[model samples]
Target: MAASAPTLLSTTSRLRVSSAAAFRAATAPLLRGEASEWVVRGEATVQVLGRSVRVRLRKRLRMPATRMEEMRATDVSIERGDNATGVLTVASRVSFFSRSSLELVQMGALRVHAYYDAGANDPAVPAAERRARAGRLSSSSVRVGTVLLPNYELRAGYNELEEQIHFDQSLGV
Candidate 1:
């Protein structure tokens, strides 16, 4: 009997933090190539496993910065750590506001894993992945920058040609 092909599954989740001031403070030093330790306090909305939950969270981060990069187009910069890790705790009310509460569940802990590489933009990236991302742009629309204007017309033409190439390849033409 022949073996069946393995199935690939993908799942996505979203998390939003309402008050990020503390989070920003914690991450600021890490972005500056320094060893830093700080705490973050905020309200978070997390959607996972088809369930939405709102809770208050406190996160402690301690990591050393590892990589930094500056973009030439807009003078924007970013930094990250090498295999950064942290921990966080969350608390949420199990029942609606009432005097008679049966139980209080607190101190739900979670582990954080983070990794960054400065060479992401290098040529080692697969061409197919690059093409897939560029294929999302529609050839019909053109938007100009409000500041330090760029050549939108030329960019549109290039994108149209790229889309045509990908379309032709799909049809085996």
Candidate 2:
């Protein structure tokens, strides 16, 4: 019997953390690299592979309840583990009260996987053998960024492209 082709699937994902302060700290490095005493506030994004994820960072320069926009952007970073590498999906998006012009809305998680070359491996791509997974970009979605936001966001529906975001973290998040 002739073999068939491999199948790919996509999903949606979202995360919200009330601790905007911590989120900002965790992502600050990528947003404003090598800057001492640099703070960020507002929306930004980070892209992995080719997918675009939305991010919103708002920090208070001072504890007192008075300040300007402070910082506004999305910062993204990726690490190549022993096995996989891809974009990290994290957010604090609030429905309704959330900013209207959001930079991006993460669609799903991005991960890395190993595939034996089809010609050298099995031609019948197993349907139940999903080694890894990743998220995709929808048309009209904004690109995530940090510090100085990118001039143009990632292309829409990027997840549909060949081998999108990559990752191999076992953190179980």
Best by lDDT: 1
Error of 2 at 48 (Å): 34
Q: For residues 53-123, could you state the per-residue lDDT of candidate 1 as single tens digits?
A: 99775555344452222211222222222223311111211111112111111212211112222233336
- List, residue by residue over 1-173, the lDDT tens digit for candidate 2: 11133222122222354475675554343222222232334566889689998876543321111111111222323323243433343322111111112222332322222222332223363533322211222332233321111122212222112222332233332
Clash pairs detected, candidate 1: none
> Runs in model 2 with CA error above 4 Å?
1-11, 32-173
In model 1, the Cα lDDT at residue 150 comes to 16
Model 2 lDDT, full chain set: 0.29
lDDT of 1: 0.30
lDDT measured at residue 159 in model 2 versus the true structure, 0 to 100: 15
